[model samples]
Target: MAKSDKKPGTRRDILNRLKSNGCSDATTLAEVLGVTPMAIRQHLYDLQSEGLVEARAEPRPVGRPAKLWYLTEAADRYFPDAHAELAVSLIDTIRSSLGENALQALVLERSRHQTVLYRNAMEDAPDLRRKLEALAEIRSREGYMAGVEETAEGLVFVENHCPICAAAKACTGLCAMELQVFADALGPGYDVSRTDHILAGARRCAYHVTERETVDG
Candidate 1:
């Protein structure tokens, strides 16, 4: 089949396909997605920018020319079949770098860092409006859609969704860890909640977070 016959594949689709196939050319990907090879190139560029896909030159004896595209080891994380060993390796690295207790502490410390960084960056804002805007800017830069609002109680930092987590639900534990980090950074007094109504569903995210003044035990 020609590359132009397939539909345009999203980043997730591209990653999943690559994970399963190991390597493929743009034409092959386009053929699978029912889109033009050019469209596949565009998606590949997007994925490449995110440190997912990679391309390599292939010397062919016939035809005009073609380059072989492949998924990096990083891209393999999207496939469930590959994630178990990857997770083990990641945990092993963590265990090697930090002792068990220290690893746990590191997780907490990093979460605290995320919150503190967000709060400190927005410290100069005069009002809640500006604060929320600042927070949104920060999260967007980090690939999230963040919003803040003032309810009847106090200010709330709502992370609309997590893009990375949405790609692989098995990593939702990491999302919970991040929430814990945010809570720790925001302090023990603020309430943090994760909503089910995510915008992107299993693809992206649509989350609602409400911050409270006093958190109960």
Candidate 2:
């Protein structure tokens, strides 16, 4: 892959600035990033091509209308919060009013729904890798920022961003429950183990998925 000319964190910084300012021109973005207008334009060009940023023409009192850059709805994922606070609060309320058993039951119910969706997606998949890839795509749409990678020994499925991080942190058992659901969704032929956990201070949640061979006794 070709490397980006923008400095490290520059893309994120640009996205953050546009997120806070709403709409701004190259001149304003340049000032915010302490770079020249030319540099800002280049970055904006790249971002626009990626469908993360958009340029709109707005009328000015003085001269011609200036084109201002704004972050697209798709770019919202790059920002913080991700609705984790609300999810965590709801989980807390359920635990407080309904008790731990109630909370477990609710999580189970949700997990069951997820299992059905995952099973449906993976049913026609031919191999373990395709099943994992399909799972990642489904999770990504649900705001997990998930992806899959191939390895010599087994496949590694990773979720870089957790939309319900706060809720998961509030209830650690959700992690184990997730592992179980994943195993169940893919059937009993594979051993799926969590290699990294975001709730445990890791930057992501990863599972090492390895297929098991059947032997006749």
Candidate 3:
């Protein structure tokens, strides 16, 4: 056989694959990474020993259960956090000295600013698909690892990673305002609903965006 030019996957690549695609068995991960299942299993075991990954038995009909590997909370250290500690500290400071109401005002202002920025970025996007693509690019640049998925019903905007997860946990207002920002950024005639939330124990955040019929007044 001829030599292959593709680079072999690293532990970080395995972590990233799990982060983006959720849980998977060693066999599946091996196939995706162009390596043998035994090699992948060894890597997974090493990661498990380091407390970065864990495996759960998934039931299989008429056969032994398969071990599904997934990233543990500790694995989050490998991903980008976008200055999580500083963001959380600022949130706490604002709420303590500026008051809860003032903190809320700041959140709203931040959402408004995001909405305007996103809108401006998507201004020339011609249609909903293009607009969603533009929005995903903007968010991915901001460390959300965002992408748009097309479905028969509509589009699913997926954020494979949340850089502000720490700040969002400290102040729930950030998540709420985020949903609002997405709605406003997409403009009218479209409804954006959060289908998954990382804070709620999901591996990633997903938004279902569908068009709503508008009747002329």
lDDT of 3 by residue, 1-217 (tens): 6323243656778999999899999989877887667778888999999999999998999799999999999999988998999999999998899899999999888888999999999889988888889999999999998989988768999999999999999999998888889889888878999999999998889999987887889
Q: Give the range where candidate 3 is weakest over 10 consecutive residues by summed lDDT.
A: 1-10
From the highest TM-score down, the ranking of the candidates is 3, 2, 1
Q: What local lDDT score does residue 102 receive in model 1, on the 0 to 100 scale? A: 63
How would you order the candidates by lDDT, starting with the best?
3, 2, 1
- Candidate 1 lDDT: 0.60
Score every model by TM-score: 0.42, 0.65, 0.92
Measured by lDDT, the strongest candidate is: 3
Which is better, 1 or 2, measured by TM-score?
2
Kindly list the per-residue Cα lDDT of model 1 for residues 1-217, writing each as its tens digit: 4534345445677776654344789878777777777877888888889888778877789875577777665763554333355655665677688766665665566666787888886678775457567867887677555666566655555543344543234334445576565555444534566543333243223233444555477
Model 1 spans > 4 angstroms off:
1-89, 96-100, 147-173, 187-190, 197-217
Q: Highest TM-score among the candidates is held by which one?
A: 3
lDDT for each residue of candidate 2 in 1-217, tens digit (9 for 90 to 100): 4333455777788886765445789888777677767777888899999999999899999999999888776785675545777878888899999999999988898889989999999999999889999999998888776788877766899886667766787877676689989998998899999998877766568899998988999
For model 2, what is the C-alpha lDDT against the true structure? 0.81
What are the RMSD figures for all models against the true structure? 13.2, 12.5, 2.2
